[model samples]
Target chain A: MSKSQLNLTRIVLQDLWHNKWVMLLALLVVLNAIAVVYTSHEGRKYTSQWDQLLQERDRLDIEWRNLLLEEQSRSEHSRITRIATKELNMNRPLPKNEIVVRVP
Target chain B: MSKQAKRKQKPQLIQWRLYVVVGFVCLMFTSLIGRAAYIQIIEPEKLRHESDMRTLRTTSREVQRGLITDRNGEMLAVSVPVKAVYADPKVVHDKNGFADMRRWQALADVLHEPKEDILKRVQSNPRKRFTYLKRQVTPAVADYIKQLKLPGVYLKPESRRYYPTGEISAQLVGITNIDDKGIEGIENTYDDWLTGTPSKQKVRKSRDGHVVERLDMVQEGESPNDLVLSIDQRIQQLAYRELKKATEANQATSGSIVVLDVHTGEVLAMANTPSYNPNSRENLQGFRMRNRALTDSYEPGSTIKPFVVAAALEAGTIKVDDIIKTNPGRMRIGGKIVRDGRNYGDLSLSGILVHSSNVGMTKIALSMPVQELLGAYQTMGLGNYSGINLEGESAGLIHDRRRWSEFERATLSFGYGLMATPLQLARMYSILGNKGVLYPVSILKLKQEPEGTQVLSPEVAQSVMEMLVGVTEKGGTALKAHIEGYPVAGKTGTARKAVAGGYGEDYVALFAGVAPVHNPKLAIAVVVNEPKGDRYYGGDIAAPVFAAVMSGALQMLNVEPISKREKVRLAANSRSVE
Candidate 1:
């Protein structure tokens, strides 16, 4: 019970009441910042993932075109046929060229 | 003391009532706060994305359609990007207070259209926020309008079809509508393959109606497949040019030429004169796109005789050296008289083919049962679809053996009482050229070369092939078709048009020929509907075109010409270019 002790207790009590709201506000700000950062980070992933998938789709499309071209080249005509026939010994058949009798 | 206590009790009851009312109000307020938190904070993000879809104006993007190209990579039809000019009528009209200086007048000058046209288009929808003033505007014109920066003016993308080769090969390419929907030809037949999927995008807009950002593209559409045709552009142009000139020169109604690959049965080129550009499809009639090769059927005349001879030989009913007794050029069988253009003596099947003998073929066909001949014709691709790339086709007319009469069968032997499309004849000859194996005519390369169906024995086909070669020799019907350096096999079919159910003097001249007869490279079936000239025979009219077309194709294909004995004879006959 000294005079200085009494003065110090009164100061501490007033300061406690006055600065209480600051601590509460700091807590709220921390919570809100964490929420915004986490949500935005999550939202950003969707567009990037879609971008990667689109690139993959493009690669697939080019592959498909190449395959089609390859297939077409494989079965494509080798040489002009009528031209080959005239040069080769290929000729149309005739009636007299056949020999037959009744099977019965 | 009692009075004071009663007064205290009354005041205390009033205080209690007041406290109760305050508590009720606080409860109600708490309920409202909870509901607001649930809606505004808990589900706010979910609703926020949804509102962007509706309130935020997003652009609906359309994809470019696929192009139709020939086998040789020539673009038959393609779509070019265009812009549609639109305006907010309310914004434009209200901005221009003066009557003469109205937005419509400016628009009319920019559009180069009449004032009334601009006025009517805008005024009809005066209050509309956006109205299309013109569609399918050129990019330069649209760019100019965009530069004007007029209020409420907008440009939307559209598609316009273009035909690069003009009318050449137009019929097969087909036409598209104003919305780029295919209407006819290959366009309609393969619409599902050509229609690309439209991709949708969702964008977020700021409160002030300015675009804030482009979100993910939602509901991605699939791209349609591309169609590669089996058409040779050079051959098509050659045939088209020659046929056009010949048709105009002869004053013929129209003409058609079809060149087919012998082994694969691929339609190398199908060209018809009097064709129209597919780009201007609205003004064109169906006639302009008719594929006469598959649509028009006629008696093939001598074009059919080779088939009959081949059938007889394949059936083992005749031998190559078998003799057929005949007068010089005529024969009578079953009350129907058959004759050739010139007299031919008694000859074997080979000699008959060399002479292009109609009477000899008739005798051979009649000697066999009618059913056997009909079966052979069917096997050779007659009386059925040729399976060509043409949209419409005729099965052609060959009566069933059950309906066949003796005279009819005999006439059919020489290409009468039987009908065939040019496509069908080309296909039949293609089988003959393919060593008696019939392949489905392919306008495009299949995943694999279709296994051919056996229609004739290989030996029988070889022997018949020799007879076919004779038709292009010194005394052959298609002597003109013989190239000095290329051996050719062909038949001339001069069919008198059927008028009033009877034969008319006017004729459809046709030639169904396999070129380089010794090693058939191309089979061509040509038809001139009605040539108003001194020469109406297939040998004179159509055979020459076949020769020109095949020769040009050979040269383009870099095929080395094979000079035969006939070329020496031709050079000797030339007598120093006399």
Candidate 2:
């Protein structure tokens, strides 16, 4: 080999030996960057799932409110009273007609 | 071999062409780097914003108003999901939304609107952005409209308030406007507590409109809270039915009733006659919408007499058994003639109330200082708000003048100079039954018993309560208010309404009382304004309503009949004697 080319190879070997720790640190940084990208992707996937669950909760809440309204409409006090008095032939007993037995 | 040697001699020309091509390639690379730098450093926001606009979105979660329930958890007011159908006129015109005439006909039929009217509303202004075709349509109707697939017609979510009990509890639960905003009664007082803010969030979405990531929250959301009132719907319905029947039978102008729990100071029922249905607003009048029990005040008439007697007893002016002369009942005071229905001879304190003799009350008032009488009235919660926290409450006016007159004092003792609402009278009776402890009235359901102020001694209050019992007995003025198995202690008042210069011909019939003299569970007041028939007296008109409501309410509460209780007491007493 030529003298200049041989001298260059020797200088490169010396520099690599001296800066081995710096090269290792650079490799770790590259790995950390890749890990960051992987974690963010997973985070987004979980967030989408959580959002869907939240939507389901809202939908269930709405259903509950609607059912409550329907139940109230069906069991109105006036309607019950009307049915009891008119359809069922019911009446409140007078105080004199009611006989109380002591339950000693 | 000769040709190859010649081509090799021209190698300089080949090197020149190669240098030119390399130089051109380097120049193109430099220009590409320059453009990239310009976009990244010099002006990147525009392009970044354009990209974000296509992917990022601002989404909001909608919230509805909370519910209002009774003490028993019965729904008084509820919010149901609905939709508002709106049209973008410009979009309709551009998209030829009117191409399908059959769809327009169906839309008009479902909305209950004339086709021509709706078409004109949309076609009137093509540039108009938004116009409501129909508001507060049911979700079923909204789904039908959605299925039509008409362009430019969109459905927006909304809420509507529904009252299941209709006019039975309308005055108390109140009504909301078309936009689900509270405008009256309990709804108006707690509007902010019932309405909650919607949540806003920034999010990133995929191409097909799926949320990929939640960026950040723009505004925090709060879930709406529910309100539970102190009213018992059963008693309210009973009272309203009874009051409505009485008002119509007597042909009275108006009426109001208030029922209060003696121990908790909670209002059990408040009903008014001429109440309108909150669901339908057609042909509604302003007068029928008022909650007269809290808003209107009239002279208390003889209802104030019991308070005066209590004050006299507290001041030590008269003993419970002392005899007061009512013979020759008509008396003149300060150039004014004060007379009773008839002359009642020497009467006890109980007899005075039974006969409802004004002469006896006038003499009792004269025996004490005017301040003592007024002080007694003030302590009983007269001339003050009931602390119910409702809108448009009337703290019935009491004269605060510095000067005093014997006639004014006499008039005040008979309940002519003072004015009070039906709710105030009920509160006074509640104090009487609660052993002279005055509790603040509450419309909202209370978690614990509130602290009370000691206004009167227990002994004086019990004595007054016992004296009031005779007012509902056989010979008493309010015999109709007597319950069969329970002892009722109440007073009747028929006050002449004051008009322009002097008293008018109209009379306000009132009965305020507490029942089951042993435990005193409830205090009720019934007021009927201006009966057109001859039966205009408080004992004739208001007493029967009080009796019906009181008996029904007592039975519902499971209060024991006084007869059985007295029998048990007698058995215990005999065993002790044995």
Candidate 3:
């Protein structure tokens, strides 16, 4: 109601309209809110990806062991010996020539 | 004009709401388009992975094949753990995979192996999945392969068959293929049951690879059945070693020895020389694979003489002690010469048999009707399968009486035209050894046939059995076959092989005998085919091997010596008498 108070109110109104720096800051804050939500969702997606890879590794380990047993049940001695002696350079002892060396 | 003014002043609520509805539809359409684009193009793999995560891909865990065990738990054959190296040709053949190839070559060089071998293994495997490099690798070798960490390379477990005692009962065990399938032997006969069928099991696993639940219908394969043979390992070893020595010493074509229990009729041991190691099956000799005792046939010579003499006595044509004058070493019968070992004057039937007089035997056979003689041979079990367990068993050669030649009849009595396997011969004598009762032969089942009938009269059997004992006594033809502590009843036979319808210079020597005459235990048939020279008589060549085998067999059975003093006395008495 007084003349001094009326003059102060008018100055405040003028400053509010003229300040672009504060308005820009408010706009940036709203943009950052949207960015934060999107980035968090992406973080969760990658976390699940790492989890899926770990499962695959475990699956492969089990598969490898099972395949080994299957291969084992099917192998034969004659074939194994052929591979061992001819391919691997292992030799079987001759009955007539084998001699016992006394172990000290 | 007044109505138009009122409508313009108040905007219609329906039109305003229509604008809001269109805006909402546009927003929904935009969202749907964005979703389609994401699924189809922007992140196809990502979406597909998301869909696949709900699905579970599983495999079965393979169990190792079961083993075969023997009766006494002696490892006749077994499967041992081993490794096979394999490679994926597709991965190996990649264009930029040459870098890995160089690394592989360097590793192979460090392991002291040629790179060519590694390359060959890689090339051998089909590119689709896997190829074998080597099997039965040692721990150290497998470790080296693992350390190399070669890409597309893997190791697998495998099994190999091993026979502990080499070439022992090779025919009985049969053989197997590289895949552990029973290709031959007992393995083939019982393959499906031995290699159990596989089954599928469904299980839910946690994302961390821990199993959470197992679904129904998952079945593990059953193990193979165990087989216990009716053979004794110790007895088999005895026969094998002795036959090996005899065949080698005589430089004969091959040799066979079969020892059977007279009462039980169990073939305790069947051994053949010139056999191959089952572990190394390639380059096997046909002769080695043959079960000669059960498959091959030859003339019995004087060994069959006793059967005819026994037949005549049993038929009431002559008594055990009846006397007959034998021609001097040679006689012409049916346009063929029947020869004895030496000249003998008039002697009792039993004495004639003891000396192995072929001339006397021909006279006896000629006197009897051919029908009765043939019937007696049939009853004695010549020309019939002994029902052995091995493949390719022969029943020997027997010509019918309707087709008999007069000379053939005369020679057949003294074991010329009639041929029999060593097993058949031993089985025939086994009837005599078992008091004229015959039993069926089997390798799998240990049980015997129902109580057999009396083939010969009990008195006739006792007398003939008593007479056969003379062959192992001082004046008997097979005196060399006598065991020290136990009394032996046996016959020695040496017949020339008939080549081009006449006797060849080479002869087959055989000593078919039964030991512990008082109580017949084992009946053995020892056969040496085509011995080197003139000294190839049964008593000379085959009897020694018989003694060695019989000795080992007796010890193995834990049979007590009848008398220790008698053993020494008999040896002294035998050497002196000879």
Candidate 4:
């Protein structure tokens, strides 16, 4: 090997040995940057999950309201009366036919 | 040796150029520091706002209105979620050509509108950001439109009010407008309590228009508050059926029936015939929309006789059995003649009421001071608002005491000079059934019984009730009002309707009564206006309606028969009918 190139290699090795704390600090900075990237990505994932849940809740609420309205229309008095009198052949009994049996 | 000397001489000149280069680098560094300071300290707010505007968005959400239910928690009205179709004209014109006939035709067909009309509406306001294509479309239709994936078209969520009972309870429960605001009846009275507040939110969205983060709540959303009414759906249906049948059978112009719970003073049912269906309002007319029981008043005819008799009894001027002479069946006072159909000699007070003698009632009313009789009427809730919270309730007309001439006083005794609504008459009868305690009427269900004011002594009210009971006997005016299994107390009124200057040939047949007289569960009033049939008497028209409705109502409520004697009588009556 040439004498100057060999001398350059020795100088570099010596400098690295002397500045070990600075090298450790540089390694720590790079690790912290990686950690920041991972945490931000995880945060975005959770936020999207929350948004999806909220939308699902809204959809279910609307469905529940619609079902309640349906129940109301089905159980309306006029409709029930019509069905009872016409389709079921039911009629109100005479007062004389209704016997009162008292429960003891 | 000469070359080494030349190199050493040039090194000194190179040092001066290095100083110039160092000064130039220092100046550039200072300029960079100055710009950083300006951005960080001088105008930070503006820069931060600009960045936020690019990432953050504000959105608003609508909420549903509340439901209206009966006392038994049966839903009478409800709000259902719907969608409104809107479009941005500018966006449509920019994305698709302004003259895109195919797109317009597709939209028109989906909306059930003409293609030319759609094109005209969009082109008329080309600069507008938004225009409504259709409002209150069914969710299924909205979903179908969404699947079309048309540009510049969007669906916004909204709500609509629906009435389940249709025309049966339409006048009492009322209806809401297209914008979900109550326009009449109980709905109008409780509009604010039934509406819900909307909410606003701030969120951050990603590049693809998906919400990425919930930033903050700008306003909190409120769930709607439901309302519970005092009306019983079963009784309301019965009353509506009976009133409609009577009005149509008699060929009457209109009719009203009011049923009150005697104990609680709650109006169980108030129905008016010629009602419009709240669901479909395409051919609705103004005349058919009135809630006649509470909004219209007529001269109450013989319904006011009981109050005058009660007042006389209270003043110690007459007893239940005191005899009054009506031998001629007619009397003249101040050039106005009062008449009864037959000459009855020395009729007892109870017999007078049973016979509905106009001359007997006039003699009793004129014996008392005018102010005292007026006071009695006012105390009985006549000519006054019943404090019911329905919209457009009328306080029936009562003249000033100073204007009570002899003729007016005498006619008022027979129910000609003053007016009272059917609801007011029902309330008065309810007071008697409640043993003279006038409980405030309510349209909402009560959690506790309210305190009642003593309008008449209990003894006087009972005596009057006994006299009224005589009126439903075999020879009484309202024999048709009797239910076989219950004792009924009722008064019948057949008044000639007043026209422009004199009385018209038309009549208002009225019957106000309470049934199961021993316990008195219900007070009902029936009015048939201007019956065109040959038989227009209260006994023939209104009393039968009262009996039909009361019988059904009592059975529905499970009110027991008063006594075994009544049961036997009912069985015998049924056997006779069979």
User: 2 or 4: which has the higher lDDT?
Assistant: 2
lDDT of 3: 0.72
- Cα lDDT of model 1 overall? 0.74
Candidate 2 chain B, run of 10 with poorest lDDT: B569-578
lDDT of 3 by residue, A1-104 (tens): 46545677777878876886897788899999989988865664554565466558645644644444345334433345469889999974322233434559
Writing each residue's lDDT as its tens digit, candidate 4 over B1-578 gives 69888888754467778889998899889888887888898878888898778878986767788888889987888777899998888887787745556766777898899978877777787788899889899888898878766677789987877787888888888888878888888888899998888888898877776677777899997767889888898899889998999999999999999999988889999999888899885887777888999999988999889889999999778776678998799999888788899987778777788899988998999889888988889989988899786888988988885766787888888888789999999999988889999987888888999788999999888678767776777888888888877678789999899999999999999999887777788999999999999999998999999999998999999988667875455434322321
Off by over 4 Å in 1: A1-104, B1-57, B86-103, B124-132, B147-154, B205-218, B401-403, B563-578
| Deviation in Å, model 4, residue A54 alpha carbon | 4.6
Candidate 3 or 4, higher lDDT? 4
lDDT of 1 by residue, B1-578 (tens): 69888778744357888889999999999999988898898878878878766556555656567877777675666666678988788876787623544554666787888978766666676688877788888778888878766766789888776766667777767788888888777787788888887777776545555444467788788776767887887787778877887788777777888888887878888888788877564678777777777777888877888888888887778876688866768876667777776776777776777676777887888778888888899988999887754567788998764776666777788787788888888888877778888988877745567777999887776666656666666766778777656666677888888888789888888888776655678888888888998888788888878888888776666555654564565334322211
Candidate 1 lands at a TM-score of 0.76
Candidate 2 interface CA RMSD, Å: 2.5
Model 2 misplaced regions, further than 4 Å: A1-38, A92-104, B1-44, B334-336, B403-405, B563-578
Best by TM-score: 2
For each of the candidates, what fraction of the native contacts does it recover? 0.00, 0.53, 0.00, 0.55
Q: What is the interface RMSD, in angstroms, for predicted model 1?
A: 11.6
lDDT of 2: 0.88
Model 4 bad stretches (over 4 Å): A1-54, B1-51, B97-100, B128-130, B206-213, B220-223, B565-578
Clash pairs (backbone) in predicted model 3? A72-B157, A72-B158, A76-B178, B174-B185
Could you tell me which residue pairs clash in candidate 4? none
Per-candidate TM-score against the hidden true structure: 0.76, 0.87, 0.71, 0.84
What shift in Å separates residue B426 of candidate 3 from its native position after superposition? Answer: 2.0
